[model samples]
Target: MPELNRRALLIGGAALPTATSLTPASANAPNNDEAFWREIAAEYDVTREIVQLENGNWGATPRPVQADYFEKLARVNRDTSYYSRRGMGRDLMAVRDRLAEALGVPSDEIAFTRNATEAMKTLIGGYNRLTPGDAVLYADLDYDSMQDCMKRMALRERAEVVRIALPEPATKASLIAAYAEAFARYPRLRLVLLTHVSHRTGLALPVREIAALAREKGIDVIVDAAHSWRQLDFSLPDLDCDFVGLNGHKWLAAPLGVGIVHIRKSALSKIDHDLATAPDGPDQIGERVHTGTLNAAAFLTVPAALAFEARIGLDRKSQRLRALRDRWVVRARSIAGVQVLTPDEPGLYGAITAFRIAGKTSMRDNGAIARQLLERHRIFTVARDGVERGACIRVTPNLFNTMAEMDLLAEALTELGV
Candidate 1:
C-alpha cells in the first residue's frame, strides 16, 4: 500500500467550544437573505484581497471550524499520550455520524476520503474485483482525473473504457439515453462512473433514472458529487447511485482536507471488508475507508459548514447561485458572437456555468480568454480549450459573492467583445 501523505495543518492554535452550542443570529428564527449571509460571513476568514470564485478549486476554512480544528490539534499535541491512549478515532466518528444524519444517509454507508479525486480513484482502482472483460463507461465532459483513471484500468486490468460526448447543453432525456445506449451496447459493462454535476460544463446528470436503469443492467454506478452536495437540497435516496464521492469543501464550505464517500446501503454487500483498518463502528463505512492517522478536524467541521448552509438553507443558496449564473450568462451572451455553452434550463446546471467566447476559433483563443480575464480583470474563473468548444470560460458563484462583483466580470467580457 502506498503511504498516504498526511495533510497540512488543518488544526492550529485556537479555541473550540466545549460542544457545538450552535447559536442562530436570532435564536428564535433566522432570515434567509443577503443579510443573513453577511452576518455569518465573519465565520470564514478569506484572504485579504481578491474575489474568490474558485471554491471549485479549493475552499478556505471558516473561522469557527478552523479554530475548533486547531484547538483540538493543540490539545492532541500537548498530550500525545492522552490523545493516542484514548483511541481518538472512536471519538471523532460521533462527529461523522452527525454529518451522515444531515446528509440523509445511514451512518454505515459513508466513508471519509481527502477529496473526491481519492474517493473516485479508489473505486476505479479496485477494478480487480470486477468480472473479466467488464467495461467502464464515462464521457468527454468528465473531470480528467476519472478519465485518466479509466485509461489506467485499460492498461492494467484489460477492461475497456467507453467514452461518450454529452449532447451539447443536454436535455434530461437525451442525457439519460446517451448512457442507456452505451450500457445496452456493452451489457458487460459492470460499472458506470457518472458525475451528478459536471465539473467542466456545469451540466447536471439525470442520476435517479440512470441509477435505476443501471441496476437493471447489473452495472453498479459511482457518482461524483463534487459539485452536488449543498448545491441543491435532496437526499441520497433521491439520486440513488451505488456509490458517491462528495467534496465538502466545494458547496458545503467546509475547511480543507475533508471529503465523504457514501456507498448506498444496498450496494454495501459488494465492497470487501478490511479495505482499510481505520476505526469505525460495527456497520460504519468509516472502517472500510479509514486509513490510519488522518486529520479528523475537517470531517468534524463539515456539520458546522452544513449548519451554516442550513441557516441560509439549500433552496435559497441554489436559487442565489442560479441567479448569479443567469446574471453572468446574460452579460456574456449579450456580447456579439459569444455562445453560452451551459444549458439555460434550471435542471441542466447550477453553481457553475461556461460560455464560448468569440475569438480565433481555436483552443489557444480559449486559453487567451482565461489568461486575459485573470491578468486584466482580477476576476477568477476556470477555462478550457479542448475538443468541441474551442475557447470557453467557466463562471462559478458562491454565497459570499455579490452582484457587483459579477457585474465587474460582465464589464471585462464586454470590453473583449466576447
Candidate 2:
C-alpha cells in the first residue's frame, strides 16, 4: 500500500481516497447539522468496510493526533535513554500539567498510568483505611478487574465485601436512592466503587449524587470514570469524588496506553505509596504507582489530542455523541422483542447504549446476535456480560460515526428481533 493508504488503514481500518475530498461545512453550521458533523468526521480515517459501533473499547486518534504521535515516537526512538533520562521528565510533566488543566484538577493530584485498569489497581490496592469487619461496596456494573481488586483487598484486610445491584431502568433519583440504601444498610462501608459510565450497558450513573450520599455516610468513593471523562461533559469536581481513574484513549482520542489517576491533594493520605519506591518522595502523587517505563510517545502525544478536543470543544462533542446515540435508541426501543438497557432520561446515557432481544439473555445468545448483526448487516457491535440481569449487546459510536449507521443498527436489530 502507498504510505497514505497504509497509515489510513492502520488507524481507521480502511483506506480513504482522500480525507479532504469531502466538502467543508459552512462556518455557521449548527453543531447538530450533519454537514458540520461530516466535516468533523473528515478528521478521522474511518473504514468503509463496516459500520463501526464498538468505539467504547478505545477511540481512534484523529489524523493530526496520530501524526503527532508518530513524530514523538520517532524522536523518542532516536534519542533513546539520553533524552528519556535528561529531557523526557520535563516533557512528561508538561503533558501532565496540560491534562490536569483539562480535567480541572491540580497537576500534583493526577498521575499517568498505562490505562485506567492500572490506575484503579494502584488506588484500590494502595487504599489503607480499610479494617477488618468494615465493608467495601461495589455494584454489578463495576468493571471486572476493579471488582476483583475490591474482593482481594477485602480478603487481605479481613473486610467484608458488599455487592449491590444497581436498579434497572435507573433514573437519577432511583440511582441515588440505591446507593443511599446501600450506605445505610452497610453502616460499616468505608469505601465504594462507582462507575460513571458502565462498560456493560453504557448506563451513565449520577456519580456526584451518589458520592454525596456516600460522603454523608462517612464513606469514601473511588470512581471508575474510564468511559466518562470525555464522553460526558464534566470534570473531577463535578463528580465530587476524591479519587478517580480515567482514560485518554477512550474518548480523548489519544493513542492507546494512556490513562489517569486522580487523588485529591487532601485525600492523598488515604492511599498508601506503591510497593516500589521512586526517586520522588512519598509526598508526590507520582509515587503512588510506579509503572517504571511507559509509552513515552503515547504520553507525549496527549497535548496534541487535548488540542484537537479543544478546537472541537468537549461540550459540543458530548452533544453530538448523544445525538447519535439517541437517534438509534429511539427506534430500537419501539421494536417488538427488543429490550433497551440504558434509559432515555437525560444525563443517564451518552454515546454508548445496549439492547437485547427478548428471551436472549445468555452470553452465548447475545454473542450470536452480535455476530449475526456483523455478518448480515455489516454493523459491528460487541456482546457484554455481567449486567446482573443477563448479557447484552453494546453499541458505541464515535465522532466519525454517521447517524445513518445507527439507523442501520436499529434496522438490523429489528430484523433480528423477529
TM-score of 2: 0.94
Clashing pairs in 1: 11-70, 12-70, 43-63
lDDT of 2 by residue, 1-418 (tens): 1223322342335433334323434335678776666666778876766778899899999888999999999999999999999989999999999999999988999999999999999899999999899999999999999999999999999999999998887898999999888898988999999999999999999998889888888999999999998999998888878999999999999999999999999999899888797546758778898998899999999999988887677888999999999999899888999999899999999999999888899999999998898888777899999998899999999988877677777777788775
lDDT tens per residue, model 1, 1-418: 1222101111122221232333555332343343344444445565424555665776666666677667777777787767667866676678678878877888778878888887777666654456558788878777888889877876676777788877876788888899889889997887788888877778888889988888899888878888887786667878877678888877777777777788777666565455665335465455446555666656666666766666656777687788767777788877876677787776778878777765555666766777788777666776754435454677787755655667777787776773
Candidate 1: list runs displaced more than 4 Å: 1-33, 40-43, 127-129, 273-287, 359-363, 385-388
lDDT of 2 at 125: 94
- Evaluate all candidate structures by whole-model CA lDDT and list the values in order: 0.70, 0.88
lDDT of 1 at 15: 25
Superposed on all Cα atoms, the candidates' RMSDs to the truth, in angstroms, are 8.0, 4.1
**Model 2: per-residue Cα lDDT at residue 66:** 92
Give the top-scoring candidate (lDDT).
2
